[model samples]
Target: MITVSACMIVKNEERVLARCLDSLKGLVDEIILVDTGSTDGTKEIAKKYNCKIYDFKWIDDFAAARNFSFSKAAMDYIFVADADEVIDEVNREKFLTLKQHLIPEIDIIQMMYANQLEFNTTYNFDKEYRPKLFKRLRQFTWTDPIHETVMLDPVVYDSEIEILHMPENNHAVRDFDIFQRLIQKGTAFSEKLISMYARELFIAGEDKDFLTAESFFTGLLEQEVSEEVIKLIQCILVRCGRIKNDSELILRYALKNIATGKASAEVCYEVGEYFYNKDNIKEAVIWYMNAAFETDAELNIHYNKELPLEKIALCYEKAGNTEEANNYREQAAALRESLM
Candidate 1:
């Protein structure tokens, strides 16, 4: 059985740190905690757990802090958890099983992250994935400053190991504030900084800042850039454009990738819903037809539970496409009838 070292990075997480540490204590051979400067009992709790603690300066980049934490591991396999995340007994047992029956060739393991799984929680599924468990010898590092992710290149397997996040979304690090302050300081900073700043603006709901972000994407596109950064900028532009309903901008970006492959069914459905909400039934049907026929069933990832077939049937009837409208209505009715 491979020994597991649980690594965590934190700052002023006094409220949630103890709960997180308590969940993983005794599960791993070692617990490594790196403090970015917490004036709270977060450090005191670490001492009680005999956790090997280190100090990492508050850098605007999260990867820097996380990478620093990973360097402190002293076991064959490393497991990372956040100060606000919890791993239940069922998942912890599953993780233990994976380590005991591990294969040498599997350098990394993908973990399912379950966000907000309360018994009565309502919303679409909050399942996201990332590399959470891996071999220390592989020397995989992390990338991206804010939502940092591991950089690995060895064979990976998706284990049923899961994690739950109950983050303090309202509270943010001081560095997040600093990033926005620097955005207005000068043009000396790279477009990367601008991209990061724009994300902050979108979250904060600053209209002018969003325009600045939209401009930054345009500015970067004019320069010679890496393919990876280009794709990121395009995605950011699409999000900002949608928020502003900038039709011209949306059409331009859509055209870039629209014909290279089929347009996204989800996007078309959203468009149809947008018009339907405005009571523009005619435009809604046109977009909905374009969506359902042109796009595949797989592309409507979470629409069934959220919008469901009955809603689609209702939209068609509202648009007065009686024949096709009735077909959808019957389908939805049959589903409901079968449930009874």
Candidate 2:
């Protein structure tokens, strides 16, 4: 079996560090903990896990910290983990088997970063996968600072290995604080940080930052040119309107998004819902029809609750399309049943 090195870079994570390392104690051959100036006993906990701890200065760049940690690994494969993540028994078994005979050609392993959770009997965000495992021999490097990404050669071996993220979010404390620092220092904002700062600004209900967020998001799109990012920009524009009730800006993005083919199902639905709520049935139907069968596979991002389908069904019923109305009515019932 090949040796697996579990590595991490953390600071002020005393509360969750032990639990994170404990979960992987059996799965990895060694643990490498890199502390970026932790005042807490984070390093002391690392010693308990027999981790080969290293010290790095607190640079605002997460990629720099992460890359420094990976450089110290003395194993064939390196598995990176956050202090907030834990591996379940099923995933542990899979990792052990994969380590035994990892293909030489494979540069990275894409594991499922499951983010689903429940609180007081309500289902929260759905889970998604990200490439987290690596072969240090391939010299794979991480890029960006905030939402850092691993740069690997083509054809990453897909592993069934999955991790459950029991996140202890101090978003207001840690994330925004970093953004505040970057802003105060006049650092030429990283694209990743721009996305994060925009999100945090939105969450804080800051209207002035809406325009700034729009510019940064659009700039990121121009630099990276991703459809997903464009859709997010549209989302911010829509939310800015909702929070401010500024119909002027809302109408601009709504129309612009429709033109660019970047509008989400939620966006179209919201536009439709706005008209529907205002008793403008015809306009609402046009928008809802566009949303219901959106071409963007990612556009249906968990907001198509029964109400949206039911609303569309009602719209169709009013438009005298009994067939479409009944079809949507059935869909609404099925969705409601599934949720129940």
Candidate 3:
């Protein structure tokens, strides 16, 4: 049987920390908790578990904190965990069995991270596979018969264990602050980070958040960028234009987005919102129809799903088309039900 070290980085997670630790108790051989400046009873709770605890200074970088926690792990494999996550009894047994029977050649283990849509964070899916466990040390091996080369890719295994994510509240506000800080510091964003930032904004950003991101996304338009990045930038600018009530900003990008011959649901929804706010119900419904049927969503799927459907239903009701309104409402309800 292989020993597993559960590692976590947390701050001010006093409310849910104990619950998470309780679920992890017998499954892992050891626990390593790295506290990033917690002024709460989080340390006291860690003491109850008799886990190895380390204090890490807040560096505005989660990777840094995670790496610190992983460094303290002394077991054969390190299991990355979060204070907002837990494993149920069924999955806990599965996890323990996997640990006992796992092959030594496997370097990474992926587990399903479930209950995502409840808080509707950056992800669109309710459950997805995420790398949760790792072999502490990797042994290099050569492959092929004649011209041998070292294997570069880690051997990965997908496990049946599912980790339930039960956060008390959405962390978008905290994530937005970090994104804004990085943007203001002129830090270059990788393609993945750019996509994640756009998704988080579309899912939970307020008017102020869009306004704050307006300048940065607009700057990207002036540079040479990928087509996908351009689409993301267009979506961001459209929301910013709508929030600022700038018709020129809206129409400019709306025209650019339309010229791409592949309009995005986000831009279409924003256009519908623009017309709706102006009381042009007919034009709004036309754009909303485009959002629902014509364009694919670039960010949040709800823009192409329930959001436009709900608005179309409202517009029809306002236009005295009660039958059509009911039809669209029913379609929206059915769509949501199917996803559930």
Q: Which candidate number would show the highest lDDT if scored against the true structure?
A: 3
Note each model's CA RMSD in angstroms.
8.3, 7.6, 1.1
Candidate 3 lDDT over residue span 188-231, tens digit each: 88878888889999999999988888888888778777899988
Give one digit per residue, the lDDT tens place, for model 1 in 206-234. Answer: 44545555665677788887654554455
Per-candidate clashes come to 0, 0, 0
C-alpha-based local distance difference test score of model 3: 0.92
Count of clashes in candidate 1: 0
Clashing pairs for model 1 are none
**What TM-score, computed on C-alpha atoms, does each candidate reach?**
0.65, 0.70, 0.97
Best by TM-score: 3
lDDT of 3 at 75: 92
Query: Global lDDT of each model?
Result: 0.66, 0.71, 0.92
